[model samples]
Target: MKMLAAVVVLFLAAGLSDSVILTKCGLKQQLQTSLTLPPNTTNVLAQIVCHVQLTSNFNTSAIKTINETEKPHESQGPRRGRSAKNVRPTKVTPKPHLESGEDKNEFWTLYGLFQLSDHVVCNSTQRHSLNLCGLTCNKLLDNDISDDLACVQVLINKMTAVIPDPETAKHIHKMISLIYQPECANAKASVYFADCPQP
Candidate 1:
């Protein structure tokens, strides 16, 4: 009985230290991700959960809305064909296209970008999380002013052959820069509820 109590106390301590402000969906997502762990480990880890609050202006509803409505451009490029004169089957398979359809939801896309930014911030030359986000946003800027949709669209476009023009990239860069600027204090917000794992 004493040993069980100690384990409970330890778990409570860990949970308290890593406490975060997460939405209902965010907590659900984390539980789902945790379930993926091996059964043996899952049992041991199930008693403890950690949440970190990050700076982000996004919400679950916004993510869901965008993902369900947006679609990536389809590839209209020509396909390779083997003529009778060259009758061998082509060994090379075409590259997998990045599909942007109604299914491309914002939750996963934002999640992935934040996850990547986190990794880059921790492991790469970019030591600051805001800098890492800026680096990505800079590439998407198209004009003097930037909008959230423009940045998101550029990111989506990057998955395919359609590259954003310089003007567009500038606009996005400016927008992202504004968000990350010190006055806005929004850079950290990007990290908010960023790692919620869902079923």
Candidate 2:
């Protein structure tokens, strides 16, 4: 019995090792390499770092499920005609259980560091999704963050394409603020990146 338990523990640990919790500097480095910011927009990197810290606390496997009831009418299909400027902040809540014969217990889940959504971004087996990111939700939950960064890049491109040059930075900042909690809008990098070594 002791040997069996040891094996079981090892197996569980191995399974849990798939995800990673990145440090502030580590994440900043990853973003620096993965993202392509607009010209003269270096400050946006700090904001991006803060946004990830607030959203998932740098946990690569972080998952937040928003039930259909919380986001009514969104379960039908991908949200269309919604620009980056109008994106709403995600409301984090515990996964709810619905009784049988009730509406489908579909949930629009946010995955990984950036909390990319299943309804509008990544595809999942749970329901019909737009899959704008053209990748699986599971892909976002691993130690690898290339897929997450790619999806974010797609969003940034879309946002910059519509807005004029003068308002580009403001619009991008506003869009980032809207996607996360209200506090993220005012978050300072110094607060979150205090532990990271200066460049």
Candidate 3:
């Protein structure tokens, strides 16, 4: 019984450690400075930072969703026996927009698909690589057409070694295929805007 308990505890510890590593690797801000430079300019560090940024964004969004769901809203005061109408709704500031609808829709579609791809890619790997490519590829799909093709090529190399689980790989493959869909490819010919594209 004691041996069994020890084994279970060790398994739990290992799982906990992976969770910590995943959390540490997933924050977008953590990798921002490092990923800004071209991948070739910084060598392995840039590639690693890029991969970490993609994965970190996935984890950040997932955690944010969970936190938001569990968070108690002050607006729900009536549920807590206070007068609900007395509580003010939280005001959200809007972000600036500069792109036209077609371009915005295309960029957003790529953004959402990349987020989904990161989750699938990360799930299949036994160990995470710092060279994950989803977000970098998304840049190519967006209106900003000046991103270095070499950068995309380098990021692509990062995921090559990963042997993804068959099921998730199918989904990842599908999302990737959408990137080159005729409409999306045609739309990319025009540079939609010159400013930095928002993530």
lDDT (tens digit, per residue) of candidate 3 on 31-81: 443244444433333233233233222222211111111211211222343
**Poorest stretch of ten by lDDT in candidate 1:** 57-66
Best by TM-score: 2
Writing each residue's lDDT as its tens digit, candidate 1 over 1-199 gives 9999999999998765422233434443544443333333432121111111122211211110012122110111222342211222122222332455734432112221111221121123322233323444322222221232333333333433333676444433432332232222322222332453433
The CA lDDT of each predicted structure is: 0.28, 0.66, 0.31
Total clashing pairs for each candidate: 28, 0, 1
Q: Is candidate 2 or candidate 3 better by lDDT?
A: 2
The regions of model 2 sitting more than 4 angstroms off are 1-12, 67-93, 97-107, 163-180, 189-194
Q: Which residue pairs show collisions in model 2?
A: none
* Candidate 1 whole-model C-alpha lDDT, 0 to 1: 0.28
Give the per-residue lDDT of model 2 (tens digit) for 1-199. 9999999999999998978888778988788889887887655666676666655667888877766344222322343554322344344555674556676755557788887777666778776666668998999999878888998887777665664554444434433433544434444556655677877
lDDT of 1 at 134: 44
Candidate 2 differs from the real structure by a C-alpha RMSD in angstroms, to one decimal, of 9.3
